[model samples]
Target: MRILRFRAFTRPGDPTSGNPAGVVLDAESLSDADMLGIAADLGFSETAFLSAIEPDAARVRYFTPRAEIAFCGHATIASGVALAREGAGSTVAFTTNAGVVPVAVSPERATLTAVETSVEPLGGVLLAELLDALRLETTDLDPMLPPAFIRGGNPHPLVPVAAGVLGRLDHDADAVLRLQDRKGWDGTIPVVHRISADRFASRNPFPRGGIREDPATGSAAAGLGAYLRQHGLVTMPAEVTVEQGAETGRPSSILVSIPPEGRIRVTGSAETL
Candidate 1:
């Protein structure tokens, strides 16, 4: 089966810094094992396979190098761009494992609307474990933002830390993986600093998905939006910008829109890599 490659959530006009994902447009004949093998072979953080496609919608699946994920934001964005390139349409609904994700694409950018979202308080034990794994003390946390678990398409613990602390975090990979498995979390998203009410810098250690750090995490961003709104941190109907991947040298910009009704919208630019 032929596979297409694209970089999603990239810096405008610079494909070198975005998260690389595989896109398989003609995936109808492939089985679950086949898709997993393809994703593993591609060795990207995640790959998107579209087994069914139509003018207005498509059935899609997402896989990481290690396992199948419920949904992937960057891969979904890449799929939207790929569909547009293949003449699918300007807008399309992707029937995904999480739910129906709607995406809109222009020539230069793509935006995806996440499914229903929510935030839950993290238990003290798990929060302590996570903080210890990252060598962070409770005092290191951002007083205003605190820590909580956010769920957009997947679950992640969003820990808010003081400025300059995010770039300094280093955790044992195996321990992080064990914690993720124990808690069933996709990743631990450490939001390093809040630049402003509308801007923030975040980092994620994704040992469970077999990555040390993700350049741009749309899933986490969506969840972060929900977390912010849930805590009454941001005003209603807000547009927030996230800066990621700078530590990895492939900086990414993710635009998140939180509506008054609570659904989060994530938008980014993509390019073929």
Candidate 2:
């Protein structure tokens, strides 16, 4: 029952700045209740439980303090790095509840290929509800990248805000939880601001996970890459850098690469904690 802790999505030379996640290398004998308890006890936003490990593939489950989720980007990165440190090789396929996610691990970083991504326009009513819940107005949104629903592994309502407005994002936890319940969003609601053509800043509110905000969110970064590609916001085969968690003092850097067509790739460095 040993738990390995790692900080995923960190910058070079700074191991302490990233999202922390707990990983259970062997969870075959653990039940759902046990996993939930461990996740809650760990107090990380999400944790990874690995079982049925093969040479290059393993079955993995993600759990937050509140409940189980289909997928988690930071925890997956942490798990990949943990396995790599344990001599699992450079590449591994993780079979999650969402889908099969392939990870390439290195001593410095890990890159994960997300599941098939999809984007859809957000309905007016739903958008209005979300805005009301988050205490935002239409003027606060960036017109170039309109609000939409994006899915890489999990679903997120992508809210693109104007520069400087992202720092002012505030919402009641209960209000956001109610919106998540109605919208079936299992992931965070990412409020992003474009810093440049290939750089962005984001703040993710994850009330459904029993967290007010997440410092680094790899899954939401994947979803953002899909949104940019689908809406023609960025050219094909583009590389984007996302800066998140500064508000939380974690200051994580997430690198996302969008190919012409296929799953998006999220890359970041991880360090054992």
List candidate 2 stretches off by more than 4 Å. Answer: none
lDDT of each: 0.84, 0.90
Q: What is the lDDT of residue 91 in candidate 1?
A: 85
* Clash pairs, model 2 backbone: none
TM-score of each: 0.96, 0.97
lDDT tens digits, residues 90-196, model 2? Answer: 79999999999999986557899999988899858889989999999999999888788988789999999997898788877899999897767889999899999
lDDT, candidate 1, 1-273, per-residue tens: 469998888886665677788999879999889898999899888899997789779998988878888988888888888888878787899999899999997655789999898788875888998888877888889888778888878888888888778878877778878888887876445555798989999887887776887778888899999888878889998999998888877788899999887469999888888
In Å, residue 165's CA in model 2 sits off its true spot by: 0.4
Q: Please state the error at residue 128 of candidate 2 in Å.
A: 0.7
